[model samples]
Target: MRDEALPTVTAICRALIEQIDSGLLPAAGKLPAERRLSELFDTTRITLREALTQLEAQGLIYREERRGWFVSPPRLLYNPLVRSHFHEMVAGQNRVPATEVISARQVPASPAICAHLELPALSSVYQIRRARRVDGRLVLYVEHYLNPAYFPGILDCDLRQSLTDLYASRYDIRYGRVRFDMVPTALHGEAAAALRVAEGSPALRITRINRDQHGRIIDCDLEFWRHDAIHVSVEVPD
Candidate 1:
């Protein structure tokens, strides 16, 4: 007897699962509209819906009445989560991650950033503007201010690489913990252009504070992620 082949709906679901695992579908992300997917897969509406229903039942996908389907966020089963380094997170998933250092210069830390980083008045800090991309799609536009006292001439280093690793290996300083506050807000003016979204579009603004082993704040970064492209997850322990 020959081994049985998987059902058509199962095969469709498997294809989508492969895309998600490969980063082509993104994590905790919205799926294409049904019409688009039907065309892409050259399948009828009924078959597509059946495949989607099966995927949803398996907890691999979810559907919002008005928003359609989206990939479920990665399960955070255990560990309250220490510090999450963006560089490491992307690398672990085997994604093509790259960064562009838009600008780096010495500037007085803004009052807001200074307050977040807990710096002295009029302190000279190194500011870096960067855009992070996964597979050539812009994912995050970040503005980071670092204490010059700790990482001198950090602006000269290749920021496209991992800054966290650089700080650890080159300066013997590593981020011990971090705090994040995220909100959904409308983008406008320059921020809209950098993120390639229309003005007043919803965006996720994340303010992150990184602390060193001594519990001293090292860098305060503001990250803007296009709301349409990201899916935020909060775990509810059962």
Candidate 2:
């Protein structure tokens, strides 16, 4: 008994889903441009876009700024309690993982970063910006601020590799106790640009404050992840 008007948004959504389910719009495949899709659906661009957005919110599709819409890939599982880094965890899940250092430099710590690292005003820190990919899909952009005092000459190290390994091998330091904070956020500025997503796209911001074996704050990480790209699960031991 459920029916919609001809060329309705719901009908458009259903048609798109059927196409996806039938392999017409394959996973990770870019959809037709909005103009083409709108013409095919015999609907206004606004209506077609609304349907597209609805599907995006359902995790059926996604759009990258200047890149257009695409079928979403399988979501990855993320556990905050795990000590594994992005590369390890992603590979463990049988997916390819990649990280590229976008920018790295010694900079004065802002008040927020200073508080996170317990540093004095304008203290110098190693600011490393990075973008990480899973299965060749850009999913996360992170900023790592390290206390330069603990890591002399770190700017010269190969930063594309995992910092977890770098710290252990080079500095003989290990991550001891760590604190995590997460909040729903919108992508903006460099983060959005790095991920190639529209500004204000739904995202998750995860802040990690890491401590060394001596219980000194070693560094902090700001991770911006696509909301639909991860399913966060945690296991608690009794």
Candidate 3:
């Protein structure tokens, strides 16, 4: 690598990230060709590849086999045994947890919501939105859906605390199992605003479906966090 051109790769990477921040490089959009990028940055292919590799490792880009690299989407993982509240999770890690309730209301269940909760189509559902924070750093935007019949006075509960614990103690309901799925998503305008991050910024998308010992679904939650704030570890049994 030429000493003078070495800095160019870093500079170009920074510029590309800036474009992403500015919404110029939209999510799921393929980046310009490597040759084109090199030409634009006035650098060699080697330097460009180095920069792309670094970004790829940072979870910013994905290199398809035989295909070119494109901006990578976000991913989040939830642990069933980590039965702590959002606040508790952060606190245990020596961080802080803050919540800003975005909205709370009751509405008719949609088809998707009805199927998930095994409820009637017109069943009422309570939706709560809260922006989550840790150590004063914004982390995620959470949306929770509960069967209104199950939590008649949910809004009156101490929302700043662990909702699961509250349900277990107050309603005698316990979640014996939790199923979650991770998916790639772009930051919608409203979610981005709540998270205090730019729209389309890399974010981890998590859907948590909770169930009791009887295998009845309790609640469905959607969480969006900054991609960099979380690390997921998986262990395979011997």
Among these predicted structures, which one has the highest TM-score?
Answer: 2
Q: Put down candidate 3 lDDT per residue, 1-238, tens digits, no spaces.
A: 6777768878987988898777788755789889999899887898998888778658776554345666644333434457677767666666666887788888788887787788986897898888877655556888889987677798877676678888888888888788878877887887888866557766778888888767778889988866765677666558
Q: For residues 1-238, could you state the per-residue lDDT of candidate 1 as single tens digits? A: 1123236566789899999888888766889999999898887777888888777656577554456787755432211253446666666666666788888899987788778888877777888888886655565788888888889868878887777888998889988788888888776655666656456755678888889898878888888865544446556568
The full ranking of all candidates by TM-score, starting with the best, is 2, 3, 1
Ranking by lDDT: 2, 3, 1
lDDT of each: 0.73, 0.92, 0.75
Off by over 4 Å in 2: 1-7
Highest lDDT, which number?
2
The worst-scoring run of ten residues by lDDT in candidate 3 lies at: 72-81
Candidate 1: give the clashing pairs: none
Question: Candidate 1, which segments miss by more than 4 Å at Cα?
Answer: 1-82, 234-238
Instruction: Supply the global lDDT for candidate 2.
Output: 0.92
